[model samples]
Target chain A: MELAIGIILGCCALGAGICMGIGAIGPGIGEGNAVSKACEAIGRQPESKSAVTSTMIMGCAISETTGIYSLVVAILLIFVAPGLMVNILKEAINLL
Target chain B: MNRNKRLFKLVDILYISMIILPIMIAMVIKILTTPLSQGISISGARIFFSIPFPVQDLIITEAQLNSAFVLISILGVCLFLTHGINSGNLTTRHHIAEWIVEKVQGLVDGNMGEFFKGYAPFVTAILGLSGFSSLLSLCGLFPPTSDINIVAGWAILVFILITYYKLKGGFLNYLKGFTEPIFVMAPLNVLGEIATPVSMAFRHYGNVLSGMVIAVLISSALQGLSSMVLSWLPGFLGEIPFLQIGIPAVLSVYFDVFSGCMQAYIFAMLTMLNISGAFPQEEYEMRKKKKLLKIKNK
Candidate 1:
């Protein structure tokens, strides 16, 4: 049972790492593309740089959400929830 | 937790005092200091609250309390339900569903169409939190939002709402969200999907609470600096002691207005995406990309 919990946790770690790795990829590319475009627009119209930069940041921020989610879950797995699960399982096993 | 329980009780009392003390202080200060400051009154502003700061005493501006109200109301709705706080007139947590169900009290409350399907939780949360804050304010409590916990509570609420929405698809859909095109990576995707909200909540909560802390510190520092410098002002620049207001004022704008609003918006956006991400196209892309990568590696 200790091994089982160990394996479960190991899997959780691997799962969390993968979520962050893959989740980050598309958003990273999406934001890079957004910034590049915004720069082009700004270069074309220097006076409109404020507007362009604002939109670019907004778009990039939106694009960044998935990465943020991946992070949140990873932290939760590492720090918070597993403790609760472990406690619950222990109580259940003792009851049994 | 024992310490936390005591701290929370202390805060609860302070929350009650916050609603009363500032107005009382301003009134007393006014009655006593009037005729001297030429009738200058803090009570001129209809709404005032304090975000207890490192400084001697930092009273949040009218705009700050209004912003705090908007923010805390959204967050308080969640704590009202989950944190075992006694909210409303309820004596106990037995009516857990009652708090959630009042969400549907919409359309009936002259707020027609305020009850929608997907946005239901978000709207209900906002309304409930705001209503709770309003109740506290009406009862002359400082609304607890001026306290950082209220802001953190809002962040947690968003996180929970997102997680709950996403989970409706069952763990299978959640699992598939990360790597479902093939059997190998399906498990990885599952883990990634789950971690999203935890990050979003912390980032947002940190941003908003820290931003409030910054604004208070800046204003207080500036207040102290201006008064001290005025006495030392070269007689030539005597007219310009308060001219340095722009420095702290600008910092106040960026920290309190821009960053604060952006953090709140990010919290909401992530909340919307949590459940919405369950749609299958994202998985299909992940799977397709995974297969393509495998072939290229081969």
Candidate 2:
């Protein structure tokens, strides 16, 4: 019983770590590309800084939504699924 | 000059405190109530009251219903207070409100063109409700947008409008759009259309809910860390939550102010873009006709 619980937990921890680690790379590159281009645009036309910045932030926020989705999945894996796992184990034991 | 700068800084601090004070009250309520309701054991857990009413007793629970009630009441109060705008002398409040209305109208006009400029009020209302509901979390009230059902309902409304405009362009064309590029892509196009609203609701709901969760975790960690550090001191003084005083407020700025406002803007911008995208050829023809008529008149 102890071994099974430990393995379940270890898998969850591994899944959450993988979810966040892999998820972050896409948005990080997207945001860096966006901000670099935005900076160039602002430097070329200083008066259009506000417009450029707002557009840049909007695009970046959309890109970051995928990262946020992965974070939600990681959070659920870390905090919520473990509680459910214990319940499932209890149900299994009762069946026996 | 130095004195002026100091005075400005003081005012900024005062304004931030006014914002933070309400959030602090909300945090206290959440900390006291959330854990006990979730069956987590902690000191003073029994004293917590679950703000949400029981769900099983009624057709719909009062939790989300109350949040919507709160939002509508706030909108009602603002409309009542501004009811004087049409009557007589232009008050400063009326002037500012009208200015905002004009700006929203200009935004819609620029993006969606003159034909759809009439939707400025609709756009403003969506933005106002979204932004206000998100901000309401700071006042210790449950934000309506946190409810997926509530946000999904909003998305459905936008979806209906998008469908209506698309059909208006031509029902035949709308049907033809699904099979474009190849016939196998029709199912994918249909799925893409459905994904729009699902994505919007999920994005907004997820951001706000995560922000709330993170704030709770950080504040609790701060309390524990402070208690451990202060253990070297004697008596109940060591148990006091010294770190909780002003630390969480810094994090709340990003979670509440920045994220709240940005999500609101993004939701509204996406709504406008999608709605306008539905009327592309219609708007182009309208503009081209006006230009040709102008040249003929000259």
Candidate 3:
């Protein structure tokens, strides 16, 4: 029982760490690419700066939603799931 | 002139007292409640009270209270700004109100076209509520935006609006839209439609919650570090978490102010875009033509 609880807690922490670490990379790269392109577009058409900037921000924010989803999952795993899994495991052990 | 100056000085004193009194009262309460030996602990919003109901008890939380306060303050500001109006003589408050209205109108017009100008007030309300809710964290209160339920409610409202606009085309057409290209894609389309509100709610909630979590973590870390570093000093002075002073302010500026404002703007922009995009172009054109015909006939 002790071992099971320990494993559950340890795995949850690892999973949360991996979740955020891996999940952030895509959004980081995507946002960087977006901002760079926006800069290039602004350079090309100096007159449409406001329009390009707003569009860029909107697009970046939308793309960042995926990262936010991962963050939410990671937080859930870290804060909520371990205790829940441990409780379930304990109940199963008791039933057995 | 002397009498007028004295009255102005008295007003200044009153204004200063109004600001300081709250802080003084709060400090007194804190000192009375909290023991000196205990370090500051970060936690979720406290449940103030709960009401018993038939099915389940309704619990009122700090988020609800703070949000209510924010709403009331916003209402008060709006009332103050629009208290008196005149065509010839305008106050600075009038200018500020007009500027806010113009900006919201411009944003709606730019994003959703001139036809959707009527949604400016709706967009402004969302922007104000979300932005102010998040900014409430700066006052050391639990921001309502950090609560998933609050953001989810807003997202659901936007989702309903989106569906309503889409249904304006036709119920059959709205269903048919789900099977575009191939019937096999219908499930995916349905899932995508459902994901819209989920994503919006999660995105806003996660961002604000993460900021809050980080702020709390950093503050507690600073408290520990400060005590360790200042251990060599004398009694009360050593206990003081000096490192917690200026650093959190800088973090709060970015996390509370910038992130809060950006998320609010993005949420408002997405609301406008989704609602506008959901409206079928053909239907819009037909309505436009009908309106034009009516005007011409009149």
Predicted model with the maximum lDDT: 3
Q: Score the docking of each candidate (DockQ).
A: 0.06, 0.56, 0.83
TM for every model, in the order presented, reads 0.39, 0.79, 0.86
Off by over 4 Å in 2: A83-96, B1-63, B280-298
TM-score of A-chain in each prediction? Answer: 0.83, 0.92, 0.96
Q: What is the interface RMSD of candidate 3, in Å?
A: 0.8
TM-score of each model's chain B: 0.40, 0.74, 0.83
lDDT of 1 by residue, B1-298 (tens): 6997798677655555554455455345335533654421122223345657786577654334444554544444344344444443554443765655564443223222222244655545544443443233232223333344454556566556555644555567755555657778866765655456445545554344344445555656666677677766677564454835567566656655565446544444445445354434455457668889999999
Clashes of 1: 10
Candidate 2, which CAPRI tier?
A: medium
lDDT of 3 at B166: 91
lDDT of 2 by residue, A1-96 (tens): 888899889999999999989999999999999999999999999999988998999999899888878877887898778879988998999999
Indicate the worst ten consecutive residues by lDDT in candidate 3 chain B. Answer: B21-30
Instruction: Give lDDT tens digits, candidate 2, residues B1-298.
Output: 6996687567556545544454455556556556454531211112222444576332343235434554555555455436456657787757778887888888888778767878987888788778777777676556667666777888999999899888765667789888989989999999999998988888888788778777788888887899899999899989898999888888888987788888888888889989988875764576678889999999
Best candidate per TM-score, number? Answer: 3
Clashing pairs in 2: none
The runs of at least 3 residues in candidate 1 whose Cα sits more than 4 Å from the true structure, single-residue gaps closed, are: A1-36, A42-55, A60-96, B1-191, B216-246, B279-298
